[model samples]
Target: MTAAPSLDSKYYEAARPRSLGERLTGAARQRIHADFLRLCRPGPETTILDVGVSDVINDAANGLERHYPYPHRITAVGLGAAEAFRAAFPSVAYRQVAADCRLPFADGSFGIATSNAVLEHVGSPENQRLLLAEMARVARTVFVTVPHRFFPVEHHTAIPLLHYTDAGFRWACRRLGKEEWAQQQNLILMSRRRLAALVPPGRTARLGRTGLPLGPFSSNLFLLLTP
Candidate 1:
């Protein structure tokens, strides 16, 4: 599978200042976090679990802490082998964990568990379930976000490929001399109905679901679930 280009530089440059502005303007780290604050009703005593934390210098925890109620503990775990995350949030706790599937945490260990765009990169449906299960087991609430299936894969890289059916999309790619792009390597696309099945029915409840602008009409769906 061809690795997508670093979303760090381009995304960071544009999204960073905007994110900081959100913090200043009280946007909280995207819609999910805004929903989290509403649903979880986080206080200074709350603790958060952030899965699949990246190797970025300014991690989400700090950003959330800045916006949302602070003095709360945030534990971030990810697969990357970079100390940048550690150095970035020296005051907060940080750990390195595999993003493939299993999460090493006890049941109901946190008030909230969050994963932003992590499930798509999990590589397989089974692994995605494992990650979701772990997210549910560790926290009473789980929040996740991913690119909508309707969104073209190349659109993620700012290259708009033709809008094709799931099968037709791949077939058309092959005809267009881009067959290799069709391989189902990572970034599994899932529907909202499918995602709702991941957590326990009785324990889970959708806090919010909305499409945020990725470009203009295109956007990513963000969900906040209580499990």
Candidate 2:
């Protein structure tokens, strides 16, 4: 049997990341917050669930509490130990759960659910579907963000070549000495197309761009779906 891929959690957090500018720029940050507001349509009555939230340095959950308009409660889930998340978010509610596994919440428990650049790491078609399905099942509306496959050199992955092709991503990962995990490209590519089917069969998928014009396909792709 092939040995499981080992990822350096600390290294992954340390590497200069692509979203740094988005985190640093006030205007960029506002746009993201605005887009999230537009996508989730959160209101005083709305409840939000942020899945795959990490607590280490540069974690998205760090400023999330401040980004969105307050008056609503937010729950965050992460792959890191739940205790770690609790410590980081202190007053906010949080949960630590496997990214590609089942969620710990009850069915139809939330008003909205959002995940930013998270689905790509899930690494399995079955698990991808499970994750999306869980999101749809629990929340009235679901919002997901992913790096468009066409996005250029967004970051290095297990793939050796960096042009967004499956082979290229695999090559990059291999170069990173993560060939075992590199094969997860299937999940990334699969996510781009398959997310449309996550909503109720009759609902249509709403695609939102990052409002950037570099290309018809921006590095960031957002989807909002409802029953």
Candidate 3:
């Protein structure tokens, strides 16, 4: 019999890792960065609009900002103050934007629109689709990643098994006194089917998994949409 991959709880927060989780996240993000470059194949002149970059100043926070060779070609947007993110990536332009609103960019302004592990935090399913639609509107190609819903560990709250179900996950979160996580405003896990359904009717989208690929149990899922 084959051995199943071990996903230790200490490093389960792949979305936004902390402490011991950071080591796992750093490595996983490196892999994600490499895959992004390989699959998206952006050129030196390709302007990238990165959606949902965090204000957190950790080394693992923004993989593209850290790994991309041309920071000047990257424009990042998020819901937090850009001061910290701007300080971290001085050459990359940063913009502050609401999570659910249309991106403040003209149509086809960028060659690519990219986001990592941010779709789950955008509130309802409607908001999630809106983010995708906005990304599609502003760029000819869209590359977005979200934590896999069935990836064994629940990312935000870091609880296992019980988080497989929304009602059960909320009940467990409340019992653990994590009131914020129990709220729908914080997170909504994603599966490939759910993600596929979010793409606009006429658009062409390719879905794949990367980062800690334990087959169907891979830690992350990505959507690559192109015109």
Candidate 4:
């Protein structure tokens, strides 16, 4: 089995605010924050578990803690300690755990659980399912985000059109001078239908698009699941 790509890969780095993708992601973040507020209705006492938190130095690449109304209530988990994150958000709790193992928290331990843009890099469909199941198991409400497969521009490689139609997109990426990114093995583009199917049958869930100028064909898919 292919190992998951490292979180340090350039593919996961934050884009500059001036870049088109980052601008769109910033807009999407606002909508995501609003939806989370409405769906989870987090309060001062609410406990949030943010799984697979990005360790990137860039604030934009980090997790939902930045947007949460109560950052102190969030427990951010990552595969390794993120010194930069710790320095930036001194009040937020951070935990490090093995990437391949189950989440360290007990079932329904948090009022909200979230992960952003981390699912595609988990390496396989089975692992993706496990990640989602764990999120659902540990929180009464779950919010997750992933890049939409059919988006015209593939966010990671910044290549247009080929990601959806070509199985050889990786090769195409290398041919287009994105050799370094193409070498990283773990990105698996996902569609709304596939994401919906991944939810365990009993969970009540809704799926929608955010990051406009593309509307339903937006670059990201936002999923909310509740028990």
Candidate 5:
């Protein structure tokens, strides 16, 4: 059987200048960085488990370690290109993991666990839940960020409204001679309510909004869950 596309594969790379929407998204990401640091309070001795590594070719600031104060204590996990990623960022530890299995880490192995704009690309809601549960199991606090469905334009395709409403959009793109984009089936747009429901019950979840001014309808959503 053919293997699924890895997160570090060239299929995910977008090497271009930031669009107006992307610049706005970047602003929101900055807020997420600050909030994660504030909430997690990482120190030189604090062990942080970063569930997904960022696209080093596209945006350098997209990774958690970019804003993280202590790089020596951060360990990043990814599903591909571990050698290249490790060589590029030698200071941080890198681990390769299977896409469909449990994370190979002990319970409470780290002080904090985090992922950036990674939830939507994990395939389905079930896979997303598995990732969340693993993150929670390995750390006392979890900080994750995913694209908000209410955002006017989808970050991956740069298409507005149609992506959220049209399930056959990828198929239509293929018919219209855009075959490359049609292969992106992993992205799943999520709403604030749906995102909130994914959090474990009784946990303190503070949802933060970032981007252009519609409040919850912002471009990105951040979920900060603490024990």
Candidate 6:
């Protein structure tokens, strides 16, 4: 990946001193990983393309990288620098994706394609739809995940119910010193209806909840789609 030295400054580039949020997030991801394996049932030779992998230096940050039995079969792409990720999982091929969030591969490039907690960061609803289309374009099976808006605590800022509305959430984020997350392009809350509309036409999209199941108020949302 051609990430500049400056790019790694923003994310968690260290292993020690992990926060409670990161720890909990990691545990949730482990559950997601289990679900992924169960649903996909990938064989040893099955290659997976993991879109929008984080460069955060934590054991729990990239769940598949930390525990996957076949690391070499994974190809990960992201916008930020991944020097630490490369060092940690040398078997996985890491690529620097552009800000447009397009996957640079042909149709059916991998057996399966996946992205975790990245839809919110891609800007608008239109952009989110495009991401879904691209992932579907490049793989036979697509699995994507995003945080639920009603999760009680906002995943990015860790604030409570102030994020129930768009205007109020932005205002509160600025007041609470989370100015970065205030920007819609940086972070936007997602609901069940919002996520359901993102899948392109003709695809059989099966939406599910994970982390905690509280009917409409779940901790996370996942999409398992097929063309």
lDDT of each: 0.57, 0.59, 0.77, 0.73, 0.69, 0.79
Q: How do all models score by TM-score? A: 0.71, 0.75, 0.89, 0.87, 0.82, 0.90
Question: How many Å off is the CA of 209 in candidate 2?
Answer: 2.0
* TM-score of candidate 3 versus the correct structure, residues matched by position: 0.89
Clashes of 5: 0
Model 1 pairs in collision: none
Q: How do the residues 1-227 of candidate 1 rate in per-residue lDDT, one tens digit apiece? A: 10122533322332354464224212324555565576668677777887766564443323443445453388777665546656655655766675456777888988888766567666677777778778788888777765555544432222244533457656666677655445555335555655666654456566234334344333455556663
lDDT for each residue of candidate 5 in 109-190, tens digit (9 for 90 to 100):
9999888777877776777877888888899889888778777766666566665654655655556564555443456667
Cα lDDT tens digits, model 3, 1-227, are: 00011211212344444665576667767878888898889999999998877666565678899889999999988766666678878999988776455799999999999998777767788888888898899999998888787778776667787877778888888898866776656667788888888996567889999876778978788899988
Highest-TM-score candidate: 6
After best superposition, candidate 4 residue 158: deviation in angstroms? 0.7
With a 3 Å backbone cut-off (N, CA, C), the pairs that clash in candidate 4 are: none
Over 4 Å off, model 6 = 1-16, 213-215
lDDT score, candidate 6: 0.79
Off by over 4 Å in 4: 1-9, 177-185
Model 5 scores worst on lDDT over the 10 consecutive residues at 1-10
Q: Which ten residues in a row have the lowest lDDT in candidate 6?
A: 7-16
- List runs of model 1 lying over 4 Å from the truth: 1-29, 58-72, 151-155, 159-164, 168-181, 200-202, 211-218
**What is the Cα-based TM-score of model 2?**
0.75
lDDT, candidate 2, residue 155?
A: 30
Q: Total backbone clashes of model 3? A: 0
